[model samples]
Target: MAPIAAHPVRSAARTTLHTVTVAAAPDAVYRLVADVSEWPQVFGPTVHVDVLQEAPEEGGEQLLRIWATANGQVRNWTSRRVLDPAARTVTFRQVVSAAPVASMGGAWRIAPEGDGSRVELLHDYRAVDDDPAAEALIEQAVDRNSTAELDALKKTAELGADRAALHFSFHDSVRVDGDAADVFAFLDRADLWPERLPHVARLDLREDVVDGQPVVQHMDMDTRSPDGSTHNTTSIRVSFPDRRTLVYKQLRVPAAMTGHTGRWTVEPAAGTDGAWEVTSWHTVTLDPEGVRALLGPDATLADARAKVRHALGANSSTTLRHAKEFAEARAAGAPDGAGAEGARATT
Candidate 1:
């Protein structure tokens, strides 16, 4: 999947701006992020915090009592955290049930940066009290806490890659050269075999909503080898027709084979000569046995990554080749009075 863009949840008033560069990889930094208890470990203060409440549902609400010191000022605030993993985003507020002196909330973004990674954190906070004299003190603390929090995260991600590996993800999209309607038509034909591509035995369109927005389409597919060995699994398929993108979350896979959530994005077609050509991408989690197992036990890490990319890239190329052929062929056969010249390929 592709990484998320910058997500900053800060005070609309711009009262708090804690920005810093971390010397760490995105995964390593996310470790501390996924769990807020690690705050005291990295920050000098944040001596303690207690959860006041937790909702019964996923991405539910949690009330917190945070005690910390920043820039020579000691401040305590009660806040709430709203977890939204499906969206790869989280929201925060000052209170869950009971109000407090201030509210704190933010969003996190993790992305690949060269051999390591980059993580950006943006959070907004406000002081609830009317202590006019305490505003500056609270502002300084906010700045200090936010900066230190990120620094500690960097210390962990950049230098901790060898100690413990961490992983967080952002959804990605692969582009197809054709227009949005054309892409949707091809995907609508998932029941067709690996004729358009390999490892796909079928496509099941679960629901066709007249609402005209993309919804989840549960899929059943069969992946077979030349020897007739075949594997089948159920996947959750979701697409954004307006964006010409599709995402697949693998649910069930046969033994000996592995798969997970992956976004098969179809970007707006682009070409040097202004011809529509699909640009595709494949993003997946690391295989269970790690890169070594994927590329053979003797292969190095770099080799494993390169080999995996080559393999997936090859698969993408094949699919694109087939999609191009399908679109071009469909366009070539002029239907009597059909809107061929007026055909719109704008995703």
Candidate 2:
């Protein structure tokens, strides 16, 4: 008798569902989910999102590259997403996933519910080589991230009439007569900020390096405000050396802010030799009660907005000016340590 043939077994994809009831219109919730660029600010795990390819028409298909924290580690992947505004659904499939993930896909469903909205997040994934340990890790990450994302979405969407007044973004730029690399170095090295920037009273910075390159940084700092009061803040920074960009999200913010995220960018000046342009961009979400306590009960949302704009802009401009000076000095053949000395002297 011939021997019986043997076949390998296959693992089935695991599915999970997470849902939240948000006190906002369905259209508003859908809009927040459909705009991928805002995910970094709206979702806790999302670090950055880059739209690799965009569809020409609305509610079409696009490709995205995203970096996010998973299980306390940073991971990146590419995904293809299809947006359907009519149905209020967004479906995504991962084209290239990080290790331990063989494949993954998800959908966001938004439906009207009693003048509010019911948001549903569904995910399906498989582990590489059907490893049980790997699958368990992925499961935990998905649960944690999905819950955090849903909570944030509910909070942001429920801002209702005050949404526009509560959220704002602005940028400040300076032209530096130096190399872009020098400007980037100054921004990346936050450990030296206490000596270089007068506003930095104390700072503790830690970096996670891979292959001799720093990929992520955690910072705790005491910053002196213009009023001589010190504010404590904690932040996580992601670095992109090739683009000369550093993106950060503050885990701890001032009393008047619910969320804060920013970016520092260095680029060569167009049509100029040995010149660079450095810019600092900020996005913030206001907490109405915090704002009231900080600025008195009669203070309006408009007052809070103006105050935040002025305070944040002042700090950004100061940082940009210092960075410009540091880079320029370095480019002028100043000794290796002269830039730091000069900055300290100015302070």
Candidate 3:
């Protein structure tokens, strides 16, 4: 018999480079990119980020788990990053990639540009089985997300002295005399919000599931504000059921805000059985022009801050209280009438 022929393996890696000029110091811009925890607030496509393992030394590598929107869908992956503060560079490679992505790597390079800085984002990726369709999808996603991230970085960095005034975070919590799981269920099943939550006028929810378990959710909701006005918003949510936590970022924000991200957590109350603490947290970046228009020209940042805190806090407190009632009702083997209009009236 003739010798069998052998096929050579094909190399499929493709590289892309994107750059932006920012009106900030190189080190400052580098720090924004290096700090993964803030990516959810700083990047439009980022939903959440968790640091799985920290570096042993200042410039060593660290492990990170990240969830971000790709082509309007949420996906998660783990990456290893090496930080070089001296050089103002951060390099990363995906340790575990989601479907259609075989491997991925990237680097952020920040260098001096006159009085400001030039930021370069580079990516190298390969599709699973070198599939052309998957490769194109990945390319499109990278292009869209990279542009958004760079633009946001530039805008945030240029805020200069006003960044602190423009951004803020707060949380509201309630003690629920019930099981943590029941409290989490009340939050996780947001599809029932229009029925359960008085502030929710209308809601549409879609979930992406794997193996009969929901991993991500997209929500479009119309909410009634304290002023008797209705606002429509859309958001992407990532759920961690094991931790009884749900994190989300709004894609369509109100006129008075540029960005909004939030989390809902249900945990066991310390030293208390059959009791849990349910909290709602919000982080927002204000639009100065929007704030002026919405609150009148005389409104200052402080005024806008106070208005947002009060409005958001009221809604969150109402939700937490309702969730408390729902959980306690279920725990006590009482009929689940927590979503009744009478129950909402009490809130």
Candidate 4:
């Protein structure tokens, strides 16, 4: 299983599955189950968990205190737990010999539910005393107690207010008249991007994978107007070529602004009048912080759309000019840019 959080809470049908929403994160819920020592603070005289031995690896050994009342009779027991944190599942075996547990195991799961989380508990039960009726009742008690644990954990996690979420994509795209392979040859060159793109001044390679694709590209972008003022931002980009998307996150920016993200893309589109057209779009998102007036903070979605439109227009115009120069030079057949220096002759 990828994680227990993906599954819904379903104790055996003979048992119960009670869910009481708490104000906490899934991680907080996991902590509640993993750390039994803290139960005394939450449920005095009612619950206790003690870690007997912890193996360095996941699914290691654990010991927990077991005490409860099932039929007006006080039962004291102990369990040996094997916990797999990766799966968030625990299998408990009766260790105290005297404990009436035949088979007991359950899982603490965390799942996403809108802006909050759903904590689930999956439990299994069997009777050591050969009493099926007792097993059913025991399941009910376990479900109730596990649900309460999740509720407490949630309440604690929600104490921390919600944090902002951001998603973005950006990279100036250069297209050529040739097929994908030819266009990729030029566009994939990192050095060509900094010089050709007006905003990208430098791309510092942070780490390169086996195929030499950069896992992290420390970039220095230019936000300078024609008037000379600069607003430089450093961003980290994680790229997936198969998806044709590059996500950009702003690591640093001017002191005045907040919540910045931008994306650049190249998509082939048919021209309004004729000819195949490729549009390059760039979007930037901004959110204001430290200002609480009334309503939720505003964003830069509109401004970002406008910026993408402008960039596309400028790039199409520039591309047209460059194509004209290349075609004319190729026609002349003088080894285009043969006599010229610092020339990038595109065929």
Candidate 5:
């Protein structure tokens, strides 16, 4: 690959900065900044990150390619970052600019406060051209991203390390002798979830389009709890139609979890040759305090973990089974019956 052409930095280059203090440890705040992979879950704008290289330095610095949605637009870039654990700081310089952005660099600082920590996020940037319009756009993006990241970081850090008490990852899959497209369609049409899935009591969905194609889908869900109550949460989903995968991260998780993310993927079943399999891969980070409140003082982290796993698994498994039956029925050219009421009625 060729090196990126150097764009001359202008004397009028701008800078944007923001800071906040939170009830969390300095190291805890530092980890959230130093680890770029977790940004998708902790920050609002970041959608994904791929590490291109890792430098064997004192603080585990690295080069990364990141994709993010900012100011209602999706963009990506390559960046080099250096971490300094002792100083609780991470500095970064963007090597590849997505568009009007010529160059961008910033630093994140975590300092000790009385019984808490102070976080400062800074950004200095330049535009590729001297157009005032381009500069304004870049500044808007910088301000939006920095503020959202810091706010999220404060919330996650304040949740504390104890939040990881019940963190776990698991996946479940079911094979169906039906069309892959049909199964994917069933998963993508989440608005019908309330009708199709007995546990999903209500679902509110909104889609955002880019260049006439749907890119992101945001959903607010109310699911039936074991005691006939309802649990509400919000999520942002990215759909890959060609790949038949829907990746999602919770924006508002249940009280028992600090973070939750997962993907629903469909592909041709192996060796079975004619079958398709849909899988739900899920991972959750728990909040210990919330667990105590929900499970009671006597409940251990193990118990909380078990409860969460069973609850999540049961919902996903049931959805997959329903999709399987629906797709198979469609493939067999069967007449619409009570089993298809939920899907058919929605359309």
Candidate 6:
């Protein structure tokens, strides 16, 4: 793989730090920050993290490859992290900076404050080529991501842990007898969702372009639940047109969930040309407090989990089923938006 192109040069080093206080204890906050694997489920800016090397239980160095949304774009980089649980701090230095970045390093510290805890995130970096514009972009990303992450940590820690709540993931897929690009287009063109998906009442979309190519999409959508409850969701999505995959994180999830992230992936079917499978895969951490408050005290974790699975499955299946029909029709030379509501539409 080619090395990422460096951004413009900058002269001085820049540092940013943000902090939040949670009603929960330091241990609670530390656990959440140290367990990097759970970041995708806890932080809205993190799309995915893969541990390339693990740190020992005693705390040492671990290497990771991370994909995250920064400045409305999906960027990836490798980093070496030093974890010190005894001191309740994790320090990381980027081994390879993504485009528009020269170098990056950060640390997370959890300190006890009375019965509660204080968590601080600190980052320092210089632009790729010491470019002032690049430095400004990095500053904006650091500020935005740090603030969002600290707020999420505060919320999660304050909730503490409920055995009734658990983290879970599952996927639903539909086979489409059409070109992968056609199927992926159905997922990518979110601005048309109001006309295509009946459940979607309204949608607002924004894109970030680099060299005339759209790299990221920010979407706000309103939809009605099965019980006719209206929900509004704000999300950031990273698109990989070449790979036929899109990953997204919900910055504002429904009341029933603590955190939610998912992907829409299109894969060519094995042993069959022009046939493909589109999958909607989700991972979420349920909020038992929300469940009890929203679904009544009678609701159990099982019930909450079930409700989530059912709701997600229903929507994904509906979309997949329609996408299959629409893409197949288009592949057959029908015009765009033709049969968008699917074959069941009577009008």
Global Cα RMSD, each model: 17.1, 4.0, 3.9, 20.1, 6.7, 7.3
Candidate 1 residues 68-137, lDDT tens each? 5455333446777766544434466665311223555666665566765566667665544534444565
Q: What is the model-wide C-alpha lDDT for candidate 3?
A: 0.88
Q: Kindly report which residue stretches of model 2 are placed more than 4 angstroms away from their true locations once superposed.
A: 1-8, 210-212, 270-273, 338-347
For residue 298, model 1's alpha carbon misses the true position, in angstroms, by: 3.1
lDDT of 4 by residue, 259-337 (tens): 3443333345344322223333333322333222211356344443344345435543453344334434444553633
Ranking according to lDDT, highest score first? 3, 2, 6, 5, 1, 4
After superposition of all CA atoms, the RMSD between model 4 and the true structure is 20.1
Per-residue lDDT of model 6, residues 27-94, tens digit only? 77888888887888877789777699999988999999887878877788899999998999999999
lDDT, model 6: 0.83
Off by over 4 Å in 3: 337-347
Q: Considering lDDT, which of the candidate structures 1 and 2 is the better prediction for this target?
A: 2
Report how far off residue 164 is in candidate 3 (Å).
Answer: 0.3
Report the backbone clash tally of model 2: 0
Best-to-worst order by TM-score is 3, 2, 6, 5, 1, 4
Badly placed stretches (over 4 Å) of model 6 are 1-35, 47-90, 95-102, 109-121, 127-151, 154-164, 270-274, 333-347
lDDT of 3 by residue, 49-74 (tens): 99998875468799999999899778
lDDT of each: 0.52, 0.88, 0.88, 0.46, 0.82, 0.83
Between candidates 1 and 6, the TM-score winner: 6
Q: Is 1 or 4 the stronger prediction by lDDT? A: 1
Per-prediction TM-score to the true structure, in the order listed: 0.44, 0.90, 0.94, 0.36, 0.72, 0.73
What range of 10 consecutive residues in model 3 has the weakest lDDT sum? 338-347
Question: How far off is residue 331 in model 3, in Å?
Answer: 2.2
10 residues in a row with least lDDT, candidate 5:
338-347
Assess the local accuracy of residue 28 in candidate 5 as a C-alpha lDDT between 0 and 100. Answer: 85
